[model samples]
Target: MNTAAWSRIARRHPSAFLLAVQLLSLMVYPLFDGLPGGRLVFGAFGATALVLAVWVVNRSPAVNWVAWSLAIPALLCAVSAAVFRNQALLVTASLLEALLYFYAAGALILYMMNDNRVTADELFAAGATFTLLAWGFAYLFVVCQVWYPGSFSGAVEPERARTWLELLFLSFTNLAAVGLGDVLPLRSEARVLVMLEQFAGVGYVAVVVSRLIGLTILRQGRDS
Candidate 1:
């Protein structure tokens, strides 16, 4: 496609782009995660996702500058953490990333709830918001694990700190209200966070998703 075509698509479907990159990262992550020379690659992927998230936020009702402000420091911290392998930097990055994701999720939610008309982008935004919430909680889980070592226990390595993917799996399970898998939160703080995520997951479906579905049904009925 031409540049204009790509730009048009981006303008029309910013949320779709954000959702695509995030889902694509899930597949690409395992390939680079925990392997030699993985940090640099992972950092690149993270930076790309952050940029896309900022773009999506710009399309929302939220202040675009705020997203940029958060993303810049978060990107810097993420790169520094990945390159230096510094635990302190990693913690800071995770905290910043969690905040950024939460902010973006909120923006997308506002965009979706701003109007009754359920456009294609709004539908995509719904899915994107779900992923953003999952990522935010996963990053929070990372910080929680650092603050309280052995916060999570897994079937394979009961004593070791859970991997990023493992934490993400736990986050997804909690957010989707599915039963927890191998990774279990053992600490009070971790359990509390998990409970909050469970509520968020249920509430998203009950509120945002149901609203979208109802609106779509209403629109279809009017057309028919």
Candidate 2:
């Protein structure tokens, strides 16, 4: 496709593209991290995430400068950690990632709230932010595990893929308040964090839906 075509698609379906990239990374990480070119797969995931972050930064007028400033260093840290294979650097990269996603989520939420009429793009952005919340927590859980061993039960293997996928799964389940017995938080800190995530999940849904519905009804009233 030409540059114009790509630009049009991006403009029209920015959230869709962002959601696809994030979901793809989450799904592919565990499945392919065990195979060859694992580093490459990780690099690709980080690249796509960075691209989405840049897109959000450019699209958001008010926070674009802040987003750009933070995103550059986060992207650099991600690349550096992957290249150098430094454990400490990876932790830094992961923390940066969580922060960046939280920022992106805030920007998207701001856009959603400000618009008088909600569009598919806005709804998709909302969903993307929700998933990003889970993603951020996944990274946080990993950090917790790193800092305090046995923070979680049923985490047997030490492989990076296992660690990530397990935590990602746990994060989502906790966020959604749908816990399976496969993994459980053993540490007090982990339990407290999980409670916080659960609260966030419920509160986010309640607020976003109510805000969107209110906006829609107000717009309709004005139109009628």
Candidate 3:
């Protein structure tokens, strides 16, 4: 309720804050999509998510400067692209963002694996890392779409470049190994990326997530 209470929670559960913001952004995005003010709103959310991600990374074993290095330029490019509608800036921003998300995901993974005992924050990091990977792949899709037009085709507009939401949906589906929906990747490069994401999804669940589950179970057994 108060600043002190919120600060304590954040201090104890940094990953939870990042995870909550990512999920909340998903819900908030649809409202602003395709609107005149959408770019500005998306930029604000992007900046917030980046900052939260950096905070989460700082809590991990990774070098904090790397996260900040990527984040500052990514933020600047995002803002410039949104303001000027520069295609080059957009592509650069997308690429930088993808790298930053992937880096953050890696840091979180390392944090989770660093200890045998799973804490509440580690559990939260698991979910947050998954979202970070999803986001990273989605940004890659954005770059792919720009480089190879018509790479993705959806039921709504088969000829046009897919919206951010559509690309993100595709990314999630592919990463989760779920059956594809109306959106499909038509280009070879896109399909290759999708396949890579599929492998990553399977490996993450089989390795990192399963390890977390095992550790939790082991702890529970010892307590019992």
Tens digit per residue, CA lDDT, model 2, 1-224: 99999989889868778888888887678777667577668777876776686586566544677766766777787788777877787788778787777788777777777767888787778778877788888888877877777788774553333367778888888877775647778789988888889998888878886788787788789889
User: How many clashes does each candidate structure show, in the order listed?
Assistant: 0, 0, 0
**Better structure of 2 and 3 per lDDT:** 3
Residue 15's lDDT within candidate 3 is 94
Q: Write the per-residue lDDT of candidate 1 for residues 112-134, one digit (tens) a residue.
A: 99988999999999999999999
- Residue 151 of model 2 has an lDDT of 84
Clashing pairs in 3: none
Query: Cα RMSD (Å) between model 1 and the true structure?
Result: 0.9
Residue by residue across 111-212, what tens digits does model 3's lDDT show? 999978899999999999999999999999999999998799999979998988899999898888879778999999999999999999999999999999
TM-score of each: 0.97, 0.85, 0.98
What is the Cα root-mean-square deviation between model 2 and the actual structure? 3.0
CA RMSD of each candidate after superposition: 0.9, 3.0, 0.9
lDDT for each candidate structure: 0.92, 0.77, 0.93
Candidate 2 deviant stretches above 4 angstroms: 1-3, 155-162, 213-224
Candidate 1 wrong stretches, greater than 4 Å: none
